[model samples]
Target: MDHRFVGTAELVETPSVAVVVDVMRAFTVAAWVFARGAEKIVLAGSLDEALAWKACRPDWMTLKDGPPAPGFDLVNSPGLLRSADLGGRTVVQKTTAGTVGALAVKEASLVLCAAFVVAEATAEALRTCESDSVTFVVTGEHGQAEEDLACAQYIARRSTEPETDAAEFLRRAARSRAATELEQGLRQGSHPDDGALCVELDRFPFAMVASLEGPLMVLRPCPTPSSTGAART
Candidate 1:
């Protein structure tokens, strides 16, 4: 299998499977929300789009950039989701990296949102789906965020090598520019707990796959496939 990595939305040609990683938050937050029982998540490319979604579906929780809006249930913070009751609820999410990258990959046959929380499951999905080539899209903050790149590299490595030192990878990613920024934000009393949650590796075991449901990019969780004991590369 051919595995490649690209920063931001730099993919020129689409691959059989596209794994989008946004470790600092985005995908990490989504995984946690799904684990907490969110029925579905809709990815919006911009804040305006997310608001439009909320306008149509008043029951859905909308999360955009900056602080949480007056009526919004939550912000794009992974730590906050841990305490939220999202059972059977639909969420509209718009982030700086993850959602933007997902929207940019219009040519992918399959799109999956990933973070360290669901890295193994994501890799197994690619293998189970018989994808010959996979592209890891590192949705870096603005330019290139180290946390996203680390998560992307980890997923790529896991696709070929089953045994991975996940702890070591998380440790390295925690020192990334994005992670550092979150840490600084925490110190400033801005989403203080989010920094820790964003770096929590392997927090969820299921992978979130994106499917086009009408005009929305709906994310649904899929159980990770068990190892088939076949040689993978």
Candidate 2:
């Protein structure tokens, strides 16, 4: 399979498969939410859309970044997701990068949201997919979001070689601007453990695949083709 890496939501084109990555938080948070048993996540294009969805579906939960929006159930923080009782609940999510990137890929036969947390599982799923080409949509602008770029590269590499070393990619992510901001947030007692949660490679053994359900882009977890062993801390 041919693996292509593109950046931001704007440059995405129709590919057989597209892996939208946002390692700083969005997709990583989604992975954790699913791990906590969220039934599915509906991707909203903006805060207004997410809020509108919430207004109609009072039983559904909403997650977004930054200050808590009115009626939002949680911030886009994996730490918060860990403690939330999302068992079988539906989630409506809006983010600066991840969700937008994912929702932008309208023509791909398969769309998968990824981050370091589910990198190995995503790659394993790609190996079994019957697509001739794969595209890694780096939600961060081209060459701008270092962590997302690193995660995309890592996913591509791991797809071809299961045992590829990830230390260097992890190092790059740790030293990125996003990581610095996350560390600052940690010191401020806001989303303190999220940084740690986002970097736990291969933490989940399933791929987060997006499918358009009516007017919404809903993400659901599909188990990987094979177990990639225990997650790395």
Q: Return the top candidate by TM-score.
A: 2
**Candidate 1: minimum summed lDDT over ten consecutive residues — where?**
224-233
Per residue, candidate 1 scores C-alpha lDDT tens digits across 16-130 of 6888888878888888788778999998877778877788879999875567676566777776667688889999888777888887774578999998878888877876778
Model 1 lDDT at residue 149 = 77
RMSD of each: 4.5, 2.4
Distance from true location, Cα of 137 in model 1, Å: 0.7
* Clash number for candidate 2: 0
lDDT for predicted candidate 1 compared with the true structure: 0.77
Q: What is the C-alpha lDDT of each candidate?
A: 0.77, 0.83
TM-score of 2: 0.92
TM for candidate 1 is 0.90
Deviation in Å, model 2, residue 99 alpha carbon: 0.5
Candidate 2 deviation (Cα RMSD): 2.4
